[model samples]
Target: MILFVSGCASTYSTRSVEPSGFLGDYSQMRAGAEEDVQLIYVNPQADFGRYRKIMMDPVSVYVTPDSYLRKVPKEQLSMLVNELDAAIKTQLTPHYEFVHEPQAGAMRLRIAITEAQGANVALDTVSTVVPVGLAISAARRAVFGTHSSIGKAGIEMEILDAETGQRLWAMVDERAGRKITGKFDKFSKWRTTHDASEYWADLVKERLESLQAEHAASTP
Candidate 1:
């Protein structure tokens, strides 16, 4: 399973360009730059706060046909999907009602895991790298370039009007695994899949909350 650092939040910026006709029907608005940690596009006129219900589709693994994950056992993939779906539900439950199916006036959240790299935990432990220093170095490297050593995870999601199928928002983000530090040796460790899941889930929740607040304030 892939591992990722905890508290690794993605930074996002919004663009006001017209949606490119690239992603088929869902490309009403497209995000800028392929390398951004979080690329978000929002309909400038949409009132996000007005949507109180959401229908989340099952999380899908969209890796390449011949990707390394294809060789992984089926049970492992299922476990990852289950964890991702549960994490999303847990994060959104506090802010909106969940529906079993799409309905009028509701929003639909579609999510997919586009890429994942599993960590070699045994290798990480035996490797002579200093945990704290390596983590700090990794953070610095992230600002300059992509560094995928232990593992990584990538995700894409879209929010649309359930009835009209109008794209309201969309984002893509990815995070890399990092070494962990602590007061004692027991707690100082490498990142894990659970840590990655929590970080991404919390990032999504925070972004949604910010959008909701912005819309709420703008309403007359």
Candidate 2:
């Protein structure tokens, strides 16, 4: 069976930070004008910076029992995953060694595209067939509103200890349409899957650096 799911409403982005089984209140950290990057799970006692090598799995397409992920064209899905992998590797290479396979003490990074809304083919057709005024209206709505019928994407990631298979950290994030901003605020642009991957990779690097600093401070 195939089931299709559209992107969540833009207003819900802030409230969506509560991941399944997450204990932290991420909403407090969210800024009004930006998408929230929630750290859903973290092992407080784990020394994250101790790991020297990491094994990153190919990005997977996650789907529920009633979902239609399988219906998505294989070539399109593969392209998205490839872009995601490349973005992550590019950002993380400066921070840690990447291993081709899992090994003792190596950290494993698992990532999945858990939700997606593809470009609206029907709307595109309509825009071409209908009057120019209607097309302009549609474009304006896409840029300023939830983009409920347009392309959007979400991803989830987990960091685990390869040896013990223990989860060390996890996060889930989603994005849709361009960001709305005040005239005085910095202009915010729409983000694609590759952008999301880069954002998360940088976040991980920052977290590791903080952990290393904390460890150094405690050593003496």
Best by TM-score: 1
Candidate that scores best on lDDT: 1
TM per prediction: 0.73, 0.65
Q: Which stretches of candidate 2 lie over 4 Å from their true place?
A: 1-34, 65-71, 121-145, 179-191
The residue pairs that clash in candidate 1, if any, are none
lDDT of 1 by residue, 6-112 (tens): 36532112122222222345434344443233456778878778788998888887766644456656787787788889988898899889997778768998887
RMSD, each candidate, Å? 6.8, 9.1
Q: Cα deviation in Å at residue 218, candidate 2?
A: 3.1
Structure candidate 2, residue pairs in collision: none
